[model samples]
Target: MMKNYHNSSLSLPRRYAITAVQAAAFFYFLHCSFLPFPAMQFPFPAMQCDLELSQNVIEAYIQIEEDKIEPMQTESPQYMSTWTWAYMQSFQEPSWHRALYKHLLEKLGKCSVLFFPIISKEEFHFTLLTFHKNERKWRHYNPLRSLGHRKEERCIDMARNFVNIVEGWLEYIRPQAQVFIETKKKPTLVKQKEGLPTLVQKDLTPTEELTLNWIMQNPLQFPFEDDMECAQQSVSSLDYGMFVMFYMDKIAQ
Candidate 1:
């Protein structure tokens, strides 16, 4: 219907106006229903301001290693029910977390969400997962429960949100890198006229020193997950069928 309207014999200007209006409406809806990465506020404090920012990522990621060993498990009930469950089950855990997430993946019958590892500096993480209906399969698990659906609308939002959400997560986690190696690497490859360039040894950069100082004082900001990234792929029914995996590397100085 919207497409046919564009093909009508309206004046060139009228047709153009219609297209612009359609585009504007589309963008408005997209923002309203999806991509709700609002700036941290009263309801939700900013990731930066709520806690201390770390200058080192390596040692910080290590200090919180134990917490990552046991991630929350949601993959199981996610497949069997239609009721709306909790907010997230994103990855950041190591051993038990993987086992639980795997178990849940096999049984999901309804929707699946992509998540950013919510690494905690205070002994826990705040994973962010998106909910999606597994429409490709027949199931009684949709929480929406028989309302008319918007296939295209949801897909577009999911697509846009996927990238923005990862970036938003990055914004929240980047400061942790300050904990490991100095933020500014000392100039190593100096060019000397002789056979080899000499390496100038110096103390940690001020930023690096500052990060270490802060961590010793305030380790509550569980900075370990700073080494983590989100699942690289977007979600789909097959995704609902299997578990998503994101990789994390311990920072080596």
Candidate 2:
């Protein structure tokens, strides 16, 4: 029966067509098993798979580039304006004003007790603005009008007046501030002399010790030189004098 079926009279064209179909199906199976299917080869022809994939890649690249860029730095406009104003005033103002402004700047830079230990540059700038406002008041009031016409004479007179006022104020407050410091147990240690050992002690009250240290370290060096006529001036304005008095009260408290 098998020999008879093989010898059947099947057409040559029909047999060739069947063999070609079989070969094509075999190749298709091999391609699907061995190779990755590209987007174009996807069965769903209407879906935008290729476009979605390209968009994701582009978005990822953009995010990576954004991460590589550094953020911009910014400064406070108010602070910059105040600093500029102070810088200009220091150069353009009179000698007395320049001296006082320079003294304040040094104190602010050092974070002195005068500013209540101002910790930030911004706070120092704010204090400077306060000083400027007080200066304008002093100009309006003209406290030294009776002193003299000459700027030098006025500066010397002002310094003498300041020394008198501060001395009187210190005399009044010394006892009280001493009591407060002792009660609070906050005595400020100070070096007696440049070469003295730290173990060396001084027989001084807390108030006297603090006062001596402050004078020694004071940037203005009040009573500037031994000569009253030629000494560099500081805090000539009454407004600034009152300002110092207010902070001194705070310190004593």
Candidate 3:
């Protein structure tokens, strides 16, 4: 019995040619049915000017140059997630953090002063994040409150200002880097305990140990200068996820 012609496969080139022809036919029909006014049908009007003057006719032609400015790109909230995670993992290296700080300041200097890093419970790493103020003043603007998902919103704004955040980190690392490097040469001691974050004490030098002790000894302070202090204090009264608020407010202040 002979195979059906329609069911038989054609050569690759022939198949592509037939597909091209069918696609062209489909488009042509679609154009004819929907777009009655094709470019050919709507011809340009002849450029004719009625000026009875000598050869001194001042002709001015407007030529539009290509736009040099690039269109702004829309990005998802987690666009910097991977890069930020990597950067955070490299926090032990002071040089890496310093380089990133310089780069972020130079590149994101134009970003709003209100823009700051925040780490959600789900997104546990810090990233360059921005929250637009719909119509309120910068001091009154809070993104978490603006987006009405109070239950899902479990984020702590790391700093009131991004500049302050970067500057603070750089300052903290400057004096501690040499000590941290020296301590890192020793064998690391890790102790895992239930209901507690992993404690790594072997990684700290004598100086770092003393510095850490001093930091832990210091009490939390609420400076009068911080604009967000009042708002933060209002929210800090809440029993849950307030640790970050307390810690960041104390350090950043």
Report lDDT (Cα) of residue 73, candidate 1.
Answer: 38
The runs of at least 3 residues in candidate 1 whose Cα sits more than 4 Å from the true structure, single-residue gaps closed, are 1-86, 89-149, 180-253
**Angstrom error at residue 215, model 1:** 20
Off by over 4 Å in 2: 1-149, 185-209, 212-253
How big is the positional error of residue 228 in model 3, measured in Å on the Cα after superposition?
Answer: 11
Shift in Å, residue 139, candidate 3: 7.5
lDDT per residue as tens, model 2, 148-228: 456434444443443343344335444454454445432323445675334323344433444433433433213222121
Ranked by TM-score from best down, the candidates are 3, 2, 1
> Please, what are the lDDT tens digits per residue for candidate 1 over residues 63-146?
344244323332211311100111122333232222332222232221133222222222111222332222211111111111
TM-score of 3: 0.24
lDDT of prediction 1: 0.27
Worst 10 residues of 2 by lDDT: 117-126
Candidate 3 on 116-220: residue-level lDDT in tens? Answer: 333332322222233221221222112223223542233223334433454465456445545555565322324447653343444434433433333334322
Q: How many backbone clashes can be found in candidate 2?
A: 0
RMSD to true structure for each model, in Å: 22.6, 38.8, 27.6
- Models 1 onward score TM values of 0.19, 0.20, 0.24
